[model samples]
Target: MGQVHQHVHIEWRGGTCRVKWWSGEYHANGRKRYESKGGFTDEDEAVTHGLDKLYEIRHGTHVSNRDGATLMTDWIDAWLGSLDHACTTERNYRSITNRHIRPFFARKTVSEVDVIAYRAFKKHMKRTLPSSYGNAVMILGMILDDAVPRLIKTSPVERTKRRGKYVKTHTRERKKDVAPETVERLARNAEILLGYQGYVLVWTMAVTGMRPGELYGLTRHYCYPFWPASDPQQDPKEADRYKDDKERYGRDGNRLPAIRVERQVQFGDGKREFFPPKYASYRTLVIPPFLAEMLARLLALHDYDWVFPARMGGCLGSANFSEDYWKSISDGCPERKGPRIRRPLPALPAVPDFKGKRMYLLRHGHKAWLDEDGHSRFAVESRMGHEVPGVEGTYSSVTVAMERAIMTTLQERWDVAAKDGWGTPNG
Candidate 1:
């Protein structure tokens, strides 16, 4: 136990009192160290403050003077250094920290960032950077929370409560899914604007629900059924293992056509590279026969490394694809004169409900389609590359029947669309 001592000053008319207390901590040289606070006229108030410090120390909730003085920038650096995140994720964190966190909390100690300061920061972010506000707050909270008991006592970031429920202060507009007919219309428009490749790209996204990055990064080696058996990239052992499996090959002794989603194109620090799919959700997607035929035709037309390449024969970047390809497809392009006077282009009609929308909505629409078809939860989640939570995910597994059913339903939809003359041209 430590005791508080009173100090008297004779320079004033009457006197003054102050207190200091120690909690049995020692310095390297064996000198006794103490935590002290002055300027209290009342001895009782000083005693109360000392007692609170002692209690905090005993309960292991105390923030030491040195630790409390740690600047927010220092803590953020230490916290970020301790984490192991993906390259893109780390880049985003650093970007957010430098842009929002560092400037606002510059030179402010961790302990000095009280609830009021945090609230003010939130307000500033909401007004100036509404789109990035939520992510900034989340990253800041993570950094501060990691400093507990070391740099600061506790985090000031708290959830806002309203009407007996906790809700997000900032919300974004939800992306809506398009109907199957709308997808076909988009495909038709894409064909007119970007040739057969664009038509295949739109249909592939609508049916497979692949992320834009994954679709753009897809190579010929991963596209099965069309992937050459004698190709050097083909694993002989893997092929031999599944060669006799009836469920995998089907009862008719024919191999299933599928695409292996193993990698995605990632652009970071102005460099484009191949990275594992998001969440490392490497999966094989089974395709219907009609789609397989479409892929076959597409492959026959090109010997490029990437299945879908830009007009310049390079991997399609999302931004460029959106602006040069997707925008013209979704928002209609005016008729223009071609190089040859007799081959003038005709005006392309816009697909309804698709204006100002992102290509990602096709993924959402695919999930909805699977759900509407009454597919099993395990099958649907697996197909979407999502991990089902809880015991259901642990116990359930996607079966041959599920894949067959999915293939059958997709083929039926293609047949119906083809009957309506919406199928790919010359496919």
Candidate 2:
């Protein structure tokens, strides 16, 4: 039998400070749970503290300093909340944590968690979740990692060749393609819905394949060539020159070509004003003539620096065409009162099928059309925002010409009216 332990208690007596410690044992699940040795100022307070610790221990909570250590759920809440993640991302994180990490590790101590436990947890997750559970494990690994070396013993996540090891499989329950024809219809519809501002947002992403966060981060200073006397070459990267290239920052008293994609507004818990991008995702793209012209026009009208926004519904907020725009118009069209709004579409990577109503289809269809038109796979990948795999299966690099080609192809396939208007502001 292990010796009874004690807990310290502090109190004031007769105008003097007093210290008391208590000793006790808690039993649960037919196991003995002991607390540190001592005498407390009062038996009740000591017993309560002892019982709480015991309950935690008997329930499989182990490792030193267990009571205060956060569970996976707590860690997740802290992480997502602290980052001010996007609405979609926060939603996804909650779903994955509750559905994946909590049920298994809710009571387990961070120090007690190991690869074996992780592997088993992953398999359980795979029973219904995607093989992407591996990806989730990686994310979980990250949260725990940030906590260790400061609060806990260490992070249990380590190198593991666990991809595709899940017991379940994934089918495309969501649209993997944005559909080409949908994009075409949306482009045509943009004129009447929200006008150029809305069209620019959708068109820019479709043509550049930039993550929505990156797209929202665009600024006039980067696109139109304004030089802070402190850094002149800073704007050249607006071309998105090469893979290893970073946004031109303060240089040797001279700026370089650059596009700064450092911030964006994302819908999160409370509609975050702006947030940082994920790793390897903060990047700028060279604008094409067609897309650049759209930028020029949009820039001329807006007072604040951003092109995709008229947040106060300025000249085009109510008019901008996004998923919300496409869906609202598709469902309300009077013509739909006669036909079922058949939104037929070809597969565009990442956009879903709407059977001829919503117009994300155009973005996908444009990609297919471009592939057939002699565009390189790299170009297609850049435009579609699809990850490009390399020789060892690593992702390929993004380049300015590559991004430019995406816009060019999009113009040929969907921007028929805007095609004639395409050209650099300087050109």
Candidate 3:
């Protein structure tokens, strides 16, 4: 057993009082943690500071005066290494810290940071674009938030007042959504440009609200045509077990086919690979009958594990999909007036809303469709692979009624698109 030790030391020197303490804790290497705070003109102030330090130590929130002697750059490097962030997230954080945070606070001690210094940092960050500035400041705040109890006594980036009112250093911009009709038009055009792959990809994303990465990572094994009895929120083993069982199909004649969102293909560490979905976005989405039949045919044709593979094979990374396929279809749609590329495509009309928009807008369109149909917030969020937040998220589970409603809405869109001749071999 380790011995308990704690004490505060006070000293008076040339018209000033200095206070220090031994935190009664040992580092992993077995060194005692010592802390000190100076610049107290009064003896009472010095004692109060020392007592506060002792309190922090006792409560296990103490940051050593000696331990934080490392420069901000070194501290940040260590802090980043210690985090369990996803590869993509870690890469972004490192980029933000090196490019923005490090230049401003590189040589400063962690303990020396205060609200005033942070305010100056924000002013400097304001020179960049809003999105860039907001991301950098948010990353810095996260770094500082993690620094406390290890490298510093407190975080300087916490909310502060200006002119007796609270102010924020960053604001997240809202996602812009497009109409479902725009999605159908894009899908029809995609079929003309890239054939079956593009048609299915566009339609699925527009109706399912799946992120690009999640769609890229989809596999035949993860697609279940039946309802799962086990609680997906419980554990991975249970979820896996539920997915593998096939007898659950046709138990409820009205039940729809479901797709499990378990993994995402992301680029990191100099290569792209399949990993679990971001923020564990592991949930099941019920597909409409038209989509379910389409998927079944797609699987039967390929007989490969990946639902949507790259033209060359393997998982389709974002760059290849965005630049090669999406851009080609979106940009080339305005042209091609004559009966070129097999047959005439009913005088393909230019879509202004699609200009400069991203593939993610399809996902936003799916959410809009759900909202338009008056699906509850909880139901929509769950299908979109987002936690609803607060007590509602804790208690909420996707009900059969909610799933059926989503399925019916998506199926209705498919019926309209079919009548419009979407996915026809010849335009």
Top model number, TM-score = 1
lDDT of 3 by residue, 1-427 (tens): 1112235677767777778777786778999766667787976777777888788777988767666676788888887888788878888888888888998997798777778888788778776645578788788888888887788778888564545446574565455556556776777667665556567778778778899998888877666432344224446757655664333332256556777787898988878888888888887788887778666666665665667766445677745777766775555444445646554443344556776567887787788889988998999998888888899989987777888888898888767646555544452
Ranking by lDDT: 1, 3, 2
Counting clashing residue pairs in each candidate, in order, gives 0, 53, 0
lDDT of 1 by residue, 135-216 (tens): 8989988887888877778788776542334545656667665676888888888877666777788889988999998999
Best by lDDT: 1
Model 2 spans with C-alpha error above 4 angstroms: 1-168, 173-181, 224-260, 267-271, 314-324, 329-411, 414-427
Model 3's alpha-carbon lDDT is 0.72
What are the per-residue Cα lDDT tens digits for candidate 2 across 324-400?
A: 45564344333232255444322222223453333444445456556766766765654454566766226555555
lDDT of predicted model 1: 0.77
The stretch of ten residues in a row with the least summed lDDT in candidate 1 is 4-13
Q: How far off is model 3, as Cα RMSD?
A: 6.2
